[model samples]
Target chain A: MKILVFVKQVPDTDDVKLDPKTGNLRRDGVKSMMNPMDANAIEAALQLREKHGGSVCVVTMGLPMATEVQKKALGMGCDEAYLLSDRPFGGADTLATSYTLAKAAEKIGGYDLLLFGRLATDGDTAQTGPAVAAQLGIPQISLASSIAVEDGWVYCDRDLGDTVQRVRAKLPAVVTVNGGINKPRYATPINIMRAQKKPRTTWTAADLGCDMTKIGTPGSPSSTKKVFEPEKRNTDTQYLTGSPEDMARALADLLENEHLL
Target chain B: MKSDYQGIWVFAEQENGKLHPTVLELLAKSKELQKHNGEKITAVLLGADVSALADTLFSYGADAVLLCENEALRSYSARPYQKALTQLSEKYRPSIILYGATPLGRDLAPRVMVSLDTGLTADAIDLGFDEDGVFYQTTPGYGGKILAHIVILERRPQMATVHAQICSPIEPIADASGELIVEKLNIEPDGDYEVLETRSAEKSGESLAEAKVVVAGGRGVKTEEDLAMLRELADLLGGQLASSRPLVDNGMLPHDRQIGQSGATVSPDLMLNIAISGSVQYQLGMQKAKCIVAINQSEDAPIYDIAHIGAVTDYKKLVPALIAKIKARKQ
Candidate 1:
């Protein structure tokens, strides 16, 4: 089995803050980390390889700094990593991003499975994974909590809100894994040292034979018109200042007075 | 030459021959948007044994229902659903299409959009049409830190997916008149994906989304045992136990009990947030709760900004006391 995993570097959302005055993201001091869900995807791939005897290669499309994530994937036991970085690829929406990734995957062919995180923290759009599958003309199972491959068939447990469905797809399919699929293993010092010497390749848009017209913001049909903070509700907040017990009593009194208790 | 696309279309999602509530909600929203352009609100439905749903759709605001029934569509496999929907859209050329952002919709919408070579905005909270008649979709982006106004330029059948409960379903008009077009769809179930079996999780009580009172925990709840305390609190309050994404991701709670963008959107009458430092993503799910009581150790936690009552103290101490006080009151 040859598996391909998609990884992304996103700002640590917990540290991301909005400047109240300007209403813009304060990205100056925020650090970037591999999307938490992507870690699960990589871990799923690694586990499948361990069970079925295969190789795992990771791919990412972002700035040069994204290679740091590629290195981390290698550190986590992936065999190879590719970084699809170019200025022309900037601001690509899910469609264009999937186009670029599909083209790159075509170039890096001979893979039986493609995996991605359920959603990215930054965009929160679960579109790219399925869009990529559509671009590649393959079947996709999104929000997969558990997956097993045997006899050229991939069985997945999809996490629908109200139900858990067991689905099976032929090999050479795309699947997106959600969190808690598996506990990702940490990179030991030896693995980290070996990862530093692993094969890491960076490709430009031209290198992937991407049509310049369909590779970036110019090709993306969707555009963000504005970014603004949601309007805050004007509710009077009553602060109960005291010891823990006092505050508990006060809250109980408040709820009682309001007939909520 | 006039543009080919006309009328607003909604993908009326159904499972087990029952219409998902979000479809009617989208229909209600579509009816509102259609008034601006004076176009018909059409529903495109693809499933097995779903012809009987056309009347319900008409009563809910659909001017016409396009029903594509086939045995292969008995259970949702992405390829057949995408192919049917894509074929219908190409034939009718709708100006705008709406999908509910459920697991099925999130999976099928992107495939359909990609096949049509169009863009789709996911999990849109609001929808409207501009003076130029382009659809303006509003969705929370950047981890719910910012709202993004998205538009697809020069695309026919502009598409979007909205989460449930974002819009109210209007009262159905009795004996509403509408056109029901039955299309013959012949597709083999021979796809890359197949469903072997489905096991719906045993649900003991009301879902977190439908709960009137939600007692939610976060990463601040240190151990798995602590969730039992929160559950006790919830049980005493006649509510349900919910959690932020971290607790769910950490496997401290089930995915369905998660309250966040990727999980469930809950608008309860009261939200008791315990040991939760409210992140933007978590807030997006419960922001609509009529009253919020946040108890965290940090006074400056962002949850305080939106909470009606803030208690800066250790939840381990405050929660037990609050629970005891409530139990006494009950006595």
Candidate 2:
């Protein structure tokens, strides 16, 4: 079995700050980490490799700094890592991003299974995985809470909001794993040391032979016209101050007066 | 090409002969938009044995219902449903297509958009039309810090998926009349995926999305036991218990009870937040609650900015006290 996982480097959501002037994420001073769900994807891949005896490769499409996420994946027991970074790939929406990833997947051949995190923390679209599967013309199952492989089929427990379905897809398929699928193992000191010497590759749009018209901003059909903070409610908040008991009584009275109790 | 696309279309999602509430909500929203665009509101029904749902669609303001029935589509597998809907879009060329941002829609819409070579804005909070009648899909992105207004400039069938409970379903008209167009499409289920089993999750109480009141706890609640107190309060209020992402990530709560950008968006009549320092992500889910009460130890917690009432006190002490006070008042 050959498994490939897609990872992304996102600004740590807790510490992320926005540029007040531009209304954009200010990544200059913030730290980046593997998207939280992607960690689960990597763990799912590593677990599959452990059970099925195959190599696992992790790929990411972002700036040069995204190689750090690839390195992190390597430390976590992935066999290979690659970063698809190029100027032309910037400003790509879900469609263009998935197209570039599909081209990259074609370049890195021979994978029976492709895995992705359920959704990126930054984009929160959950569209790229299916879009990539569509671009590749392969079947996909998203929101897989659990996965297992047998007889060239990947069985997944899909979380469908109201119900959970056990679905199975044939080989050469795409699966996006949700968080809490498994507890991601921490990289040992030895693995972290060994990860520094592992082979990691970088590919640009030109190197991947991607169409210039379909790789970046020019290729993105939808673009954000403006990004603005949500309008805050303009109600006067009445603050209740005192001991816990006093405040509790005040709240009860307030709710009763307002007919909310 | 531009003139070919007519009417606003909605995917009427149903399962086990039951209609998803969001489908009715979408029909109501489409009815509102139709008043501006002067286009017919069409409901596209796809499933096995779902033709009887056409009347319900009509009552909810669908001018026409396009029924596509196939035994293979009895359960949504993404392939057959996408094929039928895509064929319909290609033939009728709807001016816009709306889908509920449920798990099935999120799974199926993107694939359909790919086949149709169009753009789909997912999880839209609101929809509007421009002067030239292009749809403006507004959605929260970047971890709910910003709202992105998206438009598909070149696509004939503009597509968008909306989160559930964002709009209310209109009252059904008793004598509503509409056309039921039962179309036949030759769709073979050729997908590589197979459904082995399906088990409905056992829900403990009212779901967070539909609850009239929501008592949500955050990391400030200290321990899992504290969450029980919140749950007690929710029960007392005849509502549901919810949590922010950290509690869910910490294994203190289930994913279904999480309220945030990645979790379920809830709009309740009253939201009592305990010890939650509101982040942009969590706020987006419950910001639409009719009234908000924040109880946190920190006086400066951002949740107070949006809350109608604020109590700066330890939840360990305050929650029990409030529970007692409400119990006493009930007596």
Candidate 3:
């Protein structure tokens, strides 16, 4: 079995500055990191590789600088790293994104399982994984909290609400992992040395056989009209007094008065 | 053409056979937005045999309910739901659409927005339209450090997903009526993804969102053993236990039990904040608590900024006494 883990390089949401003119997040000068959740996906894939004896290839779609992300994945025990970078792939939304990734996955070819974080922290949309599954015309299990392989198939325990949902899918499916699946492993010293020498193969829009018109900003349908900082809330807060009993009674009264009780 | 945008839409979120309360809340608020702006409130309900959920939608202020029922949508999958909703929004062209910021809604909304070529504002705390006919969606931005406003100027239907309980769910009126359109779906000719089975959470138990009394511990709780006191207090109050981001980081509680920005945003009736400094991230989660009581040794802790009752006593001593008082009241 061959496993491919999808990783994205997002601006450290902490470092991303708001563009005063466009109101969207400023991409320039912001430090970037592998989407935090994708680290867990890479970890899950490495464990599967160790147990199932398969090659793990980590893939990402971003700018040229994203080679650092691929290197990070390699250091974390991935057998190979690939990047699908093209200026045309910039500003692609989830729909177009899934299409481009599906095409790249087709280019990578012969993959049994695809792994993704439930959502990228920077975007927090949680749409790309399922969207990619839809584009690829495969089975997908999302928010997977635990996973195991048995009898030529995978069983996933997904956390939905308060209960764990046990789901099964055949091999060669896409799985989006939520947090707490497993603690991501730190790169060993030897692996860190090995990552620098490991060659990173790159793919462009043409390499993936994607339509140039729909690959990036041109293909994206949504546009950000304005982004202003959120307004501060200025509500009058009243502090209650006396013992617990008195405070409780006063609180209940306030709730009733506010008609919230 | 003055934008030609006409109506407000609600993605009526349903799980299993029961409808989510936040859907009704959106309807109520949508009705208010409609009344305020002379617009119409339309609801989109997509599920298997979900028309049954429509009757209540009218009472809650929707001018019409659009029902799209399909077994393919029996479980909440991003593919089919997004496909159907994107088609509906394009066809009818609502001016604004609202979704509850539940996991399902969060997943579905973005996918639909992607397909429709529109942007979405997630975790919006407040919403209203401006004089120029653009929807003003407000959300906590900058990692809870600041609030951000998003405006969809060129987009046809401005989209937003609000956390539940920020707005009140109004009781449905007895006699409200509009067109009931049953939309037929024509999804992508061939879909790549399929949902085999979905595990639904049991409907019972004290969910953090619905808990009345939430005893929350912060970094000051110190250790896992300290949480037992919080649990005891929660048990006495017939409530649930919650923790701030610090406790989650400390592994004292799981992420789901976390009550703050990165955790669950909840609006309980009574919340006890134990040794919490009330960072904006955590406050964003519990701002809806009806009566917030803070227990901290510091007099100027940020938790006291919004707390209705604040105690400067040490949580180590105050916790046991609070539990004892609740236990005595229960007996």
Candidate 4:
């Protein structure tokens, strides 16, 4: 029942905007935190470890600052944490990221399950978990609301478009849990202090023996260099005032003229 | 990496004998791709008893339909569907494959991409080739701020899951026909996963993205009663009722009616936004509306920046009055 939860650090708010000059996220007033859904993944892993009597580990792939997420996971009861960080890992897309993670999983050795948040807040692709499972050549159950393990099998209640399916897969499977999975527990002050002493390690692409051609920008087949300004609708709104009725009348007139009435 | 894969494909997604709506849209887009590279258009369908769907696929512009049927694929357990599609892909060697950016597509396509050892762009909004004749997968990414035209320079069978409503579906021809290639694998290996039980879930509010008129509310919409008032206006205007994510999370409205990055992408003729301050996520799903009318208590709400008509007043008073005025005009 050793569970590995993969989390990511994302901008704290959904209101994040890109800097027009740099074509990158504007980090002036924003803070980075563990992606909200990943907390549920960590919670699911910690709960499973509590029941099955094994250690829960958390892993994240990003810059060195991504250890913030690892520490947060540790404070929330994860037993071990690792950061997959290095220069070569920069500019990796979901494919390269999943490949690097698969290599890390192989390097870590011996885990019954791999868990992920349903999606990263910033990326929003929700493709990495299934890709990692495919990379590992293992079974995967995604969009899970609940997950349970028994006798070397992992069962999950998965959310599909028109049905909720209760599915079970063998050990060494991957599961991506949706935000509705569970209410993540808050970290206690004592646990936060204890987390400082937890066994932590940082692995680079070289240390993971990652194929240099497949670890970063070179490994990522699809590339996006076309950054453009989002289309803006002119906002010269003609304010209709006087009274509610007057405003409504003006609006109705506008709609009628626009052939929308 | 680019040796000899020849066909352009659209995944013909169906359930219980009915085609997913986005399938038609994907086929329409794939036809545009076919014209670009001189490839034959294909509709690759997978199901237990979906042979009859080939006719619909042909009518909607598929030059051929690759139907892969197996009992294991009757329900979409990721492994078996992934295996079947992957096997068929290797055998057929399509040069370009497109899927609808749906939950099912999102679940299945990536695994197949990994198995095929190719790159896939998720939720692409457009597709085209550059001056160099290289394919570009266009999507709104980086929190919807930048429109990225991504390129897969070296992969065969370049793949992407296209956003719904990104393209207009081609007009279907009557009694159209195409080459129907039925593939039944010799061994439909069982997956490690088992489906023990299933119960029906909800889809987004009946094509909210395709509505001609959309009346959307947000956090200012407090309760079901308030929603009902908005619903009244929607019904009067012959449109659909939509809400920003807050109402959906509060359980007052189902996920189908939610409008934002995490939910459906809505493009309507007229979008009447009431009380929603509009987060980046919410605005991205919309912003395609031909007309927007914003009414909020605060004059400084960001939604007003893009709204064609603005009312810096309480929605309660403004909405009720607007409804009354519309009724009078109709009479």
Q: For candidate 4, lDDT tens digit of each residue in B102-202? A: 77899888898888877899888778998888889877654454567788878777899888777778999999998989887854655587889888765
Grade the docking of candidate 3: incorrect
TM-score of 1: 0.92
- Predicted candidate 1 versus true structure: per-residue lDDT over A1-261, tens digit per residue: 999999999987554556778767788977899998899999999999999988999999999999879878999999999999999999898888999999988999998999999988778789989988889888888989898999988889988767888888887889999887888888777887889988889999999999997889986878987677667556667788888889889988987886777
TM-score of the first chain alone, every candidate: 0.94, 0.91, 0.86, 0.88
Considering lDDT, which of the candidate structures 3 and 4 is the better prediction for this target?
4
- DockQ for candidate 2: 0.56
DockQ scores for all the models shown? Answer: 0.63, 0.56, 0.23, 0.48
lDDT of 3 by residue, A40-95 (tens): 89999988888989899889999898987888899998988889988889888665
Clashing pairs in 4: A162-B201, B204-B256, B205-B256
Every model: iRMSD: 2.6, 3.4, 6.3, 4.6
Candidate 2 lDDT over residue span A1-261, tens digit each: 988899989887443445888777677867888988888898999888889999999999999988778878999999998899989999988888889998989999898999999888777788989988888888899999899999999999987656788999998999998876887888777887899888899999888999998878887877775566667667689889889999999988977886767
Residue A72 in model 4: lDDT: 83
Query: Which candidate leads the pack in DockQ?
Result: 1
Task: Tell the DockQ for candidate 3.
Answer: 0.23
Sort order, lDDT high to low = 1, 2, 4, 3
- lDDT per residue for candidate 3 within B1-331, as digits (tens), equals 3267678899899877688888988987786687667877888898887787788888887889999888778777666777788788878888888998776776667666656656577677677766765568766543444455566655567788876666787866787676899988865422444345555554433579878778898868876678888888777667788887656543457657878653677888888898887755678789888878888776656677788777666777666765555445446
Candidate 2 wrongly placed segments (more than 4 Å): A14-25, A188-190, A242-261, B130-133, B204-214, B219-241, B249-251, B260-270, B275-291, B296-302, B312-331
**Local distance difference test scores for all models:** 0.86, 0.84, 0.74, 0.83
